[model samples]
Target: MKAVLAIVLCAFSAVGCGTRTSSEMKNIYKEDQDGVRRRDAKAEEMRYALSFGGCTYSLIAQNYAITAAHCSEESGALGTSGAAMAAGQKEAKDVQLDSLIESGLGSDYKIYKIKWTSKKYMKAQHIWTKFALKKSAVKLSIKPAKGDAVSTVGFPYDGEGQAIVSTGFLKKVSNYIVDPYSEIEGSGLYFNAGITGGNSGGPLFRASDETLLGLTVSGDTPSYYSPNRPESSWSADENDVWNIATPIWVVHEKSQAFRSIVQGGTP
Candidate 1:
């Protein structure tokens, strides 16, 4: 497959990650390329599955959770007509999608802040939430070199509250465009793994050990440009494969800045 998998940033929204897949489509019961279905009993993997705002996230820090910036209303899904807030769902003023997200993550979770958000594209928010978990959060570290094996752990298709896992090799470290308009964000690490909707903000970890590599943020599939209509750019076909992530180093670099902002200091 030589298709360009465009960044499926947030899966829930209309323009998000696209359709949800069944276990039959991807066979969650069986192992994926160099990856296996995480047993429900895996404590570490289970600790990483976080449900909130119609998406899944990784518990990156004890009090901090990382998710795609589009997970919030900034993605145009929080409009008055947006389905983000269900009927009868109510919160205090200014607590729209953020409030819904906080509630979805559980009463223990709250909106800590956001980072790497684009005012133009409004897609790479890197939504951060604060909460406590029974286990320690994954530590953010340097990005893995190309060819390094990595695995994704999160609630695929919501996985009935279970965390699903997939493995692939680190393809490269680069930037991924969200759309043809030319908007972009943080450095993205591409992996060979295939992630369906509901896997956004999941952890991309080193397979040999559980060390964190990055966070799975988006997947993309590109449409072939037709020659009859010559306005299209004839880029190499990406085969509609490959997944992308915002490297953990971005978060690691901003952790102190985020903390400072929360503490009433300049970030």
Candidate 2:
């Protein structure tokens, strides 16, 4: 599998170290708060965004959370595993994964169970419960159409673990084949939302009602060209680059376990 540039922070540079300095990252988030573009996500929005194993996840149920399938061990996206922490929390909690259900590499959605074990888990659970009391776990929406307004909420690597929100309109919807020789296909929701490393697996929501729409998958690299070419033939505009996401509907269609959990049944 090609290393997911959107999930590995070190991939931004050649030597495996991040390209942005800590101070620069902080400043970038600060400037993004102006609302013209991606900004610091609000408290309510951050409530659903969870930083898990270097990726982002959102609770679909009290015990079940959703993220990009590539982040899972079965997918070999990142291969590294770590504890999970809710936004605003200082310490990350070690929650046992009761199960890690994936639709497949093509679809890219992972729904996992958080075992109610550690004190950290209890703490995070309390927060989720309180939040859910007001607004139930984000409801899934019908397949979105082109020009539909959307927003992505996640912990971008440059945000220093703070949840950031980027708003944009859907550009297109199509099937993305991960392997041409196999039947594996992904339902791709393309948009221009600003996303980067550590944003993988975060929730993409309908801008109007905040319903679940998709999961952040990857974004266009800054430059690309044929190896034979001396100069870059194409370069992505940093201000207006397209990003890929996995529509939530794909998970609903492909994973019976996910459907069962979402419908209030055991997986």
Candidate 3:
């Protein structure tokens, strides 16, 4: 009687295992198709993304693009301004910016006119055409509320030259005063989207409408902070940090050249 009971239990366990395996097998093909669709959609959205100076930029017009002010040649932050390469391009093209239109110090945003000289004219046109065809140019939105879903498109250092997209929600909006003596005030959009060195100057888009919300500027690192009160204890955990972005409103408020571009006029 004990052997009979043991045999029945084994049979039931095998039936349950078989059922789960069959159900999972049926979903595998569907899951693969869904993944493919997502990848294709992301590729289309990032068609206008460009890589340059070990950072990312988005082509908003045929001859204009936006990036972080720190990424400009004048900043000396990245040391060298390298060639720019559009997505799907086999070779990078030597591109030059006419001038830097920055939103003051510490604001961390800039718009520049691409210099399309004779050598780069044809290729630049070709790249812009592809970008326009995909309607990848994003519109700017100054207002971003906390908890708003957002996405970032850029070439991370670890991405091996391929564009990587990260998604997160807006965590906070605050003023980042880099220098108290200089009295320079800037606005920052704090989010949790993972970003790295090469992602600097990349666009941070609102997930719902794809509007340009900000530009990726810095990521959190382990550091120390002190509060005014002596009893408070605080330490910067390497893991407990938020990625920051320069809100687009900073440029809108500070740069006249940026306004012209946004108003459908040449910068």
Candidate 4:
């Protein structure tokens, strides 16, 4: 059999090393190329599985939660549509999908019921990029910081072939996109790791006591074009590097709107 394996290389300007000046380990999460678990610290969190006609996103949040609007658009399901689809149900029906996600489905998944959707943010986006998780069953709100550690969970190439649970370390203050920085609050979470196409919208989490920081936004340097053609303008290889991701923090307001459904107490 041919030997096929996943490789994780770390070294980039995104993490903003040396200048940031921190004694902490800058690895997003330490994992083997095969994605085997040396530590399952973020197992308790929720994985927001998203699907799109072109791509599937985990809709990873900053607080160990996963969700994807693009995925819902392709599935014709929306938490606010009063008709969300279920894992077993093929038809898109008006029902809360969060409970199905919160129950901890036999080590394969964790169930989380949608009490109330984040209407504010969910409405502002192009639709595919705006969605969130909630359950009218909590209180209080806490803001995450720049250097907070977070974890990630997602289904890439069937969820097993690729590594999961990336650990993220804080990098710096920079604009991922020129002028568009204001669109994302002019701030971003940078980390060193091995993430790519299938990993988009995957969960980005924190494990100090189990909290979310953001989603798996982007990788160090990836091909803007097809991977097969490295020299192409689209290829984010040695010549061109492009890192992109929808910041989970953008939905903070929506999260606050459904404060009643905010799960968990402070650590």
Candidate 5:
């Protein structure tokens, strides 16, 4: 009976030989309008997985993008900012910023300052550094409710250059105590969504409405499976893992500084 059970488990398992191919696995992850699934076509477009440093970021406005400050090199945000001004490049090389702010989350959580005048100016300014300027941005959710379904998009290390998505519940909404060394302000949200090293700065979204909830900063590592180990021996407590995010309202509060960029008032 034990052998039979093992065979049954192996047949149902996603990994291993003779299991579903990558294409088949993709089909199983199809996103539906009902929002039960986390992946969304629109959400994917808003997210830009940064390659310079391991981090994910999203466009909040035509010209503005936000990310975890730690993702920027400890030396400084300009550590990677050295691309010569060029025209017609699909991506801006060595993209620098007009302004970069900590956004009250210490010097590590940075908000890239962009003033978009025209496509020509955006290129001249090297606005496409990490990702080309997306046409639109994600709709920010000022206040997210506890227990709300949530999803996150990131460029996890396993995904190589591809963006990966994970869904879970909003476990809590509380103040994020900032480290004295970091020096930050404001409350943040806590969720059970999966996050990895490269997921830092990724956007979390309310699954039902697809509105932006917050940006992923950190999470507890979950367990993994080994081929030599039996299925019954696999030990992982999904319930225990939780992730932290900086709320969108905090970003909104600081919008006064970049209002003209998003409002089309000035570049």
Candidate 6:
């Protein structure tokens, strides 16, 4: 199962993302009339998987993408939904980001602070850093208004009808009933949306100017594989559609901390 999934993922990475031109890469992920999905300046903010346990991440800053470190570490596997390919199929020389970073060989890592590399995820297995490009910080230092409309940009299966930018409203912002840092396997952001596999680590964005609200961490707004009969609270026909995300404020907080460590300021 793992091996086959890996191959499928490889095929996807090669076909969809590999062929994307610089312009297309910037534009392909936008919203349709339904307002179900969201968009940043770029498209499909995170690289995503098409199956369960799949995780996604996005390029939040220059070279750094904000994601649950645990999500990044856990779903960071190269297993495809997937193809039997590695995180990045091409040799390092073929990738523009890595090459540019190395071209300035003698320079410090901070020189190309905004560049990204697939190897960041490849280095960790059992994790799917499915690349979704989000344009927000990862943490929520500032509180959000409850009624604000939010957007999500992910590779959700078109079957559920929400493609790319899935739209939803911020219902609340209270002390979470459960601790967010509980465990790597269970830590995930929840919200209201008909999201799917490829949506992992996707960005939860704001409606206007597409400011980022959070990152899609995980959840089955409606689970179909359960064994219970359709007589329970969750009937087979009536699915639970909602949205969950790692607040962008959280992402920014982490980034500021890292930036401070590297560049040294009150980031």
What's the lDDT for residue 193 in model 2? 63
- What's each prediction's TM-score? 0.53, 0.67, 0.60, 0.40, 0.55, 0.44
> What's the best-to-worst order under TM-score?
2, 3, 5, 1, 6, 4
- Model 5, range 89-127, lDDT digits (tens) per residue? 224333334466445433224666544323443332212
Q: Which candidate wins on TM-score? A: 2
Q: Give, for candidate 1, the lowest lDDT window spanning 10 residues.
A: 79-88
Can you tell me which runs of candidate 2 are displaced by over 4 Å?
1-17, 21-36, 72-87, 92-96, 103-105, 117-146, 177-184, 220-240
> What TM-score number comes out for model 5?
0.55
**Candidate 2: 10-residue stretch with minimal lDDT:** 126-135
Q: Count the backbone clashes (under 3 Å) in each candidate.
A: 16, 0, 0, 41, 2, 58
Better of 1 and 6 by lDDT: 1
Per-residue C-alpha lDDT of model 4 across residues 49-121, encoded as one tens digit per residue: 3322212333222222334322222223332221121122223322234423331111111213432233323
lDDT of 4 at 144: 21
Better of 4 and 5 by TM-score: 5
- Maximum-lDDT candidate: 2
Task: Residues 1-267, candidate 1: write the lDDT tens digits.
Answer: 111123333444534333533433343223432342333324434444444435555433232344554443332222110011122211211111322223111101122332211232222212223321111233222233236666776655535434556665666666655332334334666676655556666677765656666667676322212325321222111323456766655554445543453345543
Ten-residue stretch with the least lDDT total in model 4: 1-10
Distance from true location, Cα of 47 in model 4, Å? 6.7
Candidate 1 Cα RMSD after full superposition onto the native fold (Å) = 11.8
Put the candidates in lDDT order, highest first: 2, 3, 5, 1, 6, 4
* Model 1 spans > 4 angstroms off: 1-10, 14-20, 27-43, 73-146, 158-160, 178-182, 220-240, 258-267
